[model samples]
Target: MFWSRKEKEHSSKKGEDFSEVIERIKSGDKKLRERFINDYRPFILGCVSKHMNRFIDIENCEEFSIGLMAFDEAISSYNSIKGGHFLSFAELVINRRLINHRKKEIKNSKVIPFSYFGGENEQIIENSISEKSIYLHYDRFEMREEIMIYNEKLEMFGITMNDLVKKSPKHKDSKELMVGIAKIIADNDNLYNKLISKKTLPMSDLIAFVTVNPKTVEKNRKYIIAVCLALKSDLEIIKGFIRKF
Candidate 1:
C-alpha cells in the first residue's frame, strides 16, 4: 500500500505547506538545510532506490550521492513563479539525474562479453549423439575454468562475476562507447598505471585526453577500472573474452 493518511501527516509535520518549507529552506537558513536533509533522509534515499529497483546502501552509495546532489539542485533551481510543487520538481530532478547517471555508467563501462568463451555447436566430424555430448562437456569445462579465473580477478575490486551480469548495459551503442573508452585506457601508459597503482580512475586526465565527462567516469568507475586491470595485465584468457565485445 501507499503511505497511509497518518504517515502523510507525520511527513508534513503539523500540516506545514510543502512549498512554504522549500521557501524557508531557500531563504539562507543553514540550520534548515541540515534539518531538511536529516528529516527527508528516508524520502530521498527511498526515491533513488525505488527508481533503481534495488536495495540502496545510501551510506556511501553512488545513487545516494547523486540523489542528495539532485535535491540540492532542486532547492537552488526551483521557481514558484513558474508554478509547481516542490516535491514534484524534486522528483523530476531525482529522476533525470538517476537516468543520467545510469546512462553515464553504461557509456563508461568497457564490456567484455564472457559468452565468447563458450562454444555452442560446430557440427563436428563425430556424428553420434554421445560423441557430440562429449565435445559439449569438454567445451563447457573450458568455459567454466575461464569464468572462475575471471571471477577471481573481479574479487580484487570487490565485485563478483554475478555483479557484472546484473550490471551489463543492454544498449549496443552504450556498449560501443564503453569499448571505445576502454581502448583509450588500454593504449595510454599513464592511464593504465593510475588504474593499477592508484586503484582509481584518472577521470580528469581521461576527459582531457578522451571525449568523456566526469559523470561518465564516476558512474562506470568500477567496470572501467576492472577492465583496465584485465587489459593491462597478462590475462590473455580474460582478454580473449573481450575480443567479441
Candidate 2:
C-alpha cells in the first residue's frame, strides 16, 4: 500500500506515543512484548514477502519466522527519541535483516540456471532451455550488423568504441567536452550561422577554434582529427576554413 506523506506523519506521531510500550518491552514485560508482535505481524510479513524472490527455498513459514525475529529485535533495541515513528524505524530494521539473509543465500548457493525445472536427471533439459533463452534474448545476427556499422564509422576516426569506453571520466570528459566545443563554435555569429545553415562542419576546425587547453586538445585530438581526416581534408586546411569565420 502507498502511504501518503500526511498518513506517515500521523503514524509517526502514534509511534512516538508508544515510548511507554518500548520501555515495557525493554524492561522484560512479556505481555506487552506479545502485544507488539500481534499488532505488527502483518507489516513485518509484508516486508519479508517483498524480498522473498531473492532467496532460494524460501517458503511462507521461513518468511514468517524471519519477519517475527526481525520484529522482536526491533522492539528490544529501538530508541523512539532517535526520530520518526516506531513502525518506520522497525520497518527499516526488518528490511535490512531480510536483505542480509538474501545476500548470505546468494553467496552460499551455486549459480543454477533459473530455468532448471527438475531434479538431477533434468540437467540436459536445463542446459538446452538456458541456451535457447540466451539466443532468444540476444539476437546475434542484428547485433553483428550493428557492430560492423559502428566499426566502419570508428575506422574513419582512428579509434574504437572499446578505447572510448576504457578511457577514464577525467580523460577529456567526452560528451561534455564535445558540447563545450560546439558552444564555442556557435558563439561566433558567422560560424554559428554557417553551422546552423549547413548543419555540418569539419570536426578539426570546430575543435581547434573552440578548445582552450592545448594538452587536452592533443590528448583527445584523435577523435575529432579522425572525423576531419575522414572528410578527406588536412588539419591545416580545416583550421584555415574556420579562420575565415
Candidate 3:
C-alpha cells in the first residue's frame, strides 16, 4: 500500500532480476545504488510501520533508520540462488534487526535512573524487576514481536490478521472446542506435517481424531490453523494468551 502504482509497474516488468541490480551496485555504480535505495525508501518505511503495527513517524523513529540499514545488509548478503524473493529476504532481515533493537532497548530500560541512592554499602535497585513499568513494556514488546512473526507465518497459509478477527468463534465453548482441535493437530506429528506442507487443514484426517461437526471445522478453518501454528511455534507469549481459553 505504501508503494506507488508507477513503481509497482516498473518493478513488475518482465525479465528484471534484482540480483543483477545488486550486482550493478556492487560494480561501483554509486548513482544506481543511491537511486535504488531512494526508490525503496517507501518499502523500508512500510516494513518498519508494519512491524510496529502503526504508522511510523519516519523522521523521529529509530526503527526506520534500522530498517534502512537492514535493507542495505540484505542487499549485501542476499543469495539469489538460495531460492527466495529479494524482498522476502529483506523483510526477514528487517524484522530480525528491529526485534534485536527492541531487545537492546528493553535491556537499557532496565537500568535504574537514580544513582543518588547507591553506595558501596547501600542497596541499589539490585534487580531490574523492581521497575514494574519497564518490565511490562518489555513484555508488550515481546508480544508484539511474537505477533509479527505469527503474522508472517499466517500469510504463508493465506490467512491475515483481519481474517482471524472475523473467523474466530464467538462463544467461549466454541473457542475451547477450536483450541482442542488445534491441540490434536499440534500434538500429532503426521497431522501437523500435513497441515504445514499443504498449507491447509487436513480436515478429513483431522475429523478422524475429533468428534466435532465437519461444518464447524470448515467454518473456523483459519482460526484452527492459526491456533495449531501457535502451538507448533516457539511463541511463548502467544501461547500464554491462548491458555486463557
Location of the lowest summed lDDT over 10 successive residues in candidate 3: 113-122
Q: In model 1, which residue pairs have backbone atoms overlapping below 3 Å?
A: none
Clash totals for all models, in order?
Answer: 0, 0, 0
Better of 2 and 3 by TM-score: 3
**Per-residue alpha-carbon lDDT of candidate 1 for residues 124-219, written as tens digits (9 for 90 to 100):** 333223434444543454455445445555665677766666665567776667766777887887876676555577776788776666787676
> Which window of 10 residues has the lowest lDDT sum in candidate 2?
228-237
Off by over 4 Å in 1: 1-131, 233-241
Error of 1 at 4 (Å): 73
lDDT of 3: 0.77
Give the candidate order by descending lDDT: 3, 1, 2
User: What are the per-model C-alpha RMSD values against the true structure?
Assistant: 20.1, 19.6, 10.3
lDDT of 2 by residue, 161-184 (tens): 666554423533564564455446
How accurate locally, in lDDT, is each candidate? 0.62, 0.51, 0.77
Best by TM-score: 3
What would the TM-score be for candidate 1 when compared with the true structure? 0.42
TM-score between candidate 2 and the true structure = 0.38
